[model samples]
Target: MPVVLSLNIASKTIPVDYTRTGVTGIDKRPVDGPLEVRPPGKKGSSGSGVAGDTIGDLTAHGGDYQAVYGYAREDLDYWQGELGLDLRNGQFGENLTTQGIDHTHARIGEQWRVGTATLEVSAARIPCRTFAEFLGQRGWVKRFTQVARPGAYFRVLEAGRFAPGDEITVLRRPDHDVTVELFFRALTTEAELLPRLLEAGDSVPPQVIELVHKRSVIELDS
Candidate 1:
């Protein structure tokens, strides 16, 4: 059964080498107490769905569509062995460090009932300069993209309170086979797969749909 192994929140901002803002809340730590989860408004105006969690980069980080970030403990363990580092919960800045959930294969729009909150898979976390800098690892972006287990970003469908160790129940899954890994590949390494993302319909980000349309037009012209 899938469960929230750790609920992480950034206690405070810390200085970072990347991003226009000199500070980042990427150093999330597991927190004990229940947290209110809801949509964080729109991008550039909101940060984090968890009430007390911090989002240092508002321009690209937070919104209703990206209310929460979930990374699997299984994937973390894989990286731990490869990197030879003690990768702790929240090390990757994921708000929910989950166990027994195959995030890579979770379909877009799959809904999970965690505690009282309902979360729907919305997008995949793309590696950025901040992520690379936080890890202090060279070529981290390319390396992470190559692995393509970018984790899943979820949108809060029903606001509610939840805490660590809560069991995650799959409420529903979209009928498409466009899994998180496939979506990440389409957006990154596999441009040829972009057209297939359409099968996911509105479950994926609107910008992606628009991009696919634009690509189609360009391809027809050429």
Candidate 2:
């Protein structure tokens, strides 16, 4: 059976914006309607989806931890209360809060359908210094990542809109054998992780695949 879940706009929220590059949409709230989606790419991107050539051009723009795509308003807690976490609600910052869905286990290249919108998991939760700053400590954000296993970021594969309490359901699963959580672990410290991801690069995110390729070359030469 599919993972039935729900997520509220946790205390954290981010937005998709054409202005400001820092972290688009923290103060920008999500509109109440169909959660929009679009093809992934710079062309279809509008805040959250791809770059350009998309639908309404409105979507959750930025959040480092998890991206709610496949389902909504069913699964929560494990990330919020004692079961979930206190990270995004107070740390990394996001646009919408999810009540359900384990951001960490949701693999890359996974396909999810929210209403008419479909999105593909594109990458893992990348821990950056900015996130650390948000949480107000050194390396604090990164540590929270492991503990929270923030959800995955997604690129819109189809166009649609989502609002609070919209019944969400998964239309498909991941396309690869390598899961996002596994990739995160491998990339974080597992020596074999990169190699495994490299060998399985066919299903990894494009940017990640390229990064591994470049690192592999350097490691080989060194």
Candidate 3:
């Protein structure tokens, strides 16, 4: 049984570029009270975590497919040793810092009953230049990719509120065998695994599906 160790929300501050040492919403702070979670749209386009969390780049960060970001406390512990920094909750830009959930082992499309809402795993958070700059780590993107512990992003299925200490239970799991790690690898370093993504069916992210189609066409043409 996984539990929400902390819930974080970003302030409504002006967006700043994360790369080149600029500020970004990646710095989320813990919220002590319950916050509404819902699908991304005009009213709540930021996605499912806290009501007014700000994302610097809406184009790549917030949306329906990435409504919620969850990271395991265990993984953070491992990174703390490697980075030698006191990494705290929300430091990874995750809305929920979770415990007892094997994020890497979680399959895409797996549904979890978290707090009063139901969320479905949709995609894995890909590292970017912004993340690297935020952490002030040289080659942070490549280093994080090698670790293959990208946290999970989820879509809000049933809108509700969630707070710290909320229990997360697996409500359902898709039959397909596309685990988060496999999907991340295929998307980042393992093009050879692209074709196998077909097994993920509709649960796979549309962007990845498009990439797979393009790869298949190129392979066929060659």
Candidate 4:
């Protein structure tokens, strides 16, 4: 009934001067560390809570590698087929590759143990234009965000350190079924999805909240 192998992190986005670009970038660094989640108040380059969009999470925030799940070698092929993706590239910046646990299926209020810290799958990653440039597509960024399934946004329940090959055990999953993929769609463009997702703000992280709010306002004014 459960399938989660491990979560890992890295000291930097890449080896000294190692730039991550294209689908092959996932193979650049294969290391993991204790999971860490960022809250609204967490420091950002602007001294405010900044949430990186899905693709940006791996590159924009300048984060090395954070939370990730493990799965079979072919799991990626499965997702590419399931999502109709190219499968040759990865948009998430996580240094840790995934295996069994379906990141797309992760939902709000779900709790899991990552290394020594506990995390709740609260929201989905929101892709930004910066990611489009990284992905080498002019429209891929917006297209990816619309497709959602942008991986899970984990809210850190506790702070700690982790490394590659560390096992992540899911403690419990709340009684919600809406997935991170659906959530991204609803919030970014569903227009009506923001209110419903915000209604459960306690379970949603500020980063996700801010993105939804920003999109709604942008659309409203447009």
Candidate 5:
């Protein structure tokens, strides 16, 4: 059973060179909590869904569709071996550091009931200069993209509170093969896979839908 291994929130923003905002909330620290969560409106206007968490980049980071970020502990372990760094929970800027969840393979729109809250897998986290700078890794973005282990971002469907060690129950899963890994690949590296994203229907991110439509138009014109 999947469980929240660590519940994290940024106590404050850290000044950074990579973002337009000149700061980042990527330095999240684990908290002992019954953290409150809810839909955080839209990008540029809203902040993190998790109460007390901060989103320094208002234009790009937090929104209804990306209210909470979840990264699997297994993946962190994999990176620890690859990078020889002491990667800990919340090290990847995830609101929830989860155990026993295959976040990379999780289907978009899959619903999970954690504590009293329900969250739907909405999209995959896109690597950016901020993350690369945070990790102090050269070619971090490209390497992350190549691995396609981009963790899952979720939207709060039912508002409630959750804490570390709370069990995550799969309430439902959309009947689609467009897993988070595939979605990231389609958007980043494999333009050819864009058509497959349609299988996820409305669960697909609006930006990705736009890309798919553009690809169709370009193909037709050619």
Candidate 6:
């Protein structure tokens, strides 16, 4: 059964030895007991989906479409062996470290009822400079993109509390061929796949849909 292996949150942005942007809430820590979860709201500057959590750069971080981030523990375990290190839960800055779910294969707009909250898969985490800095790996962006196991972000539908060990019940999956890994590839290395993103319909973020359409037109013109 799919379940949340760990719940993580950062109360404030903190300084880091690496990265110029100070690394922000990338250093999330696991918490015990139940914690409130909700939409980051319409404001770009909202804290994370978890109550009391904070995001440093609102311009790139918090938003309604990216209210929560989730990564599968199995995927992290694979990276642990590849990196030859013991990676802890929340190390990837995921709000929920899940088990038994395949992040890469997760369907866009898939709904999961966790505890009392309902969340729908919205997008995949895009590797950024800060994320590379957090990992302290050279050519991290390229490497991660090639590996292409970017975790999924979720939009909160029903606000409620959840805890580590809570079961995640799949409520529904949208009738789309777009998976998280596919979406990430389309956004990054594979422009040819951009047209396929349209199959996702409204499940794809509106801004992203617009961008893809623009790219499609440019490709046709070129």
Off by over 4 Å in 1: none
C-alpha local distance difference test of each model: 0.91, 0.47, 0.84, 0.50, 0.92, 0.86
Error of 1 at 25 (Å): 1.7
> Candidate 5, residue 3: CA error in Å?
0.8
* Model 5 segments more than 4 A misplaced: none
41-88: candidate 1 lDDT, tens digit per residue: 877799999889888889888888788999999999999999999999
Candidate 2 displacement at residue 123 in angstroms: 1.2
**Between candidates 4 and 5, the lDDT winner:** 5
Question: Which prediction has more favorable lDDT, 4 or 6?
Answer: 6
Candidate 3: tens digits of C-alpha lDDT, residues 79-162 = 999999999998898999999998887998899999899998888889998778777899999999999999998888899989
Scored against the true structure, residue 188 in model 4 reaches a CA lDDT of 71
How does model 5 score by TM-score? 0.96
lDDT of 2 by residue, 1-222 (tens): 233222223222334333234332232223344344444333223233412211222332332112332222232334345334444331233333455555567766666655556666655655655445444466665565566464566666566665555544666665556666777777675646676675444445555677777888899899
| Root-mean-square deviation (CA) per prediction | 1.1, 6.5, 2.4, 6.6, 1.1, 1.7
Cα lDDT tens digits for candidate 6, 122-186: 89999988888888888989988999999999889899999999999999977777999999998
Return the TM-score for each candidate structure: 0.96, 0.64, 0.92, 0.61, 0.96, 0.93
Estimate the overall C-alpha local distance difference test score of candidate 2.
0.47
Q: Which is the winner by TM-score between candidate 3 and candidate 6? A: 6
Q: What is residue 32's positional error in candidate 5, in angstroms?
A: 0.7
Residues 24-44, candidate 4: write the lDDT tens digits: 223223333333444433323
**Which residue runs does candidate 6 get wrong by more than 4 Å?**
16-23
Cα displacement (angstroms), candidate 4, residue 41, comes to 5.0
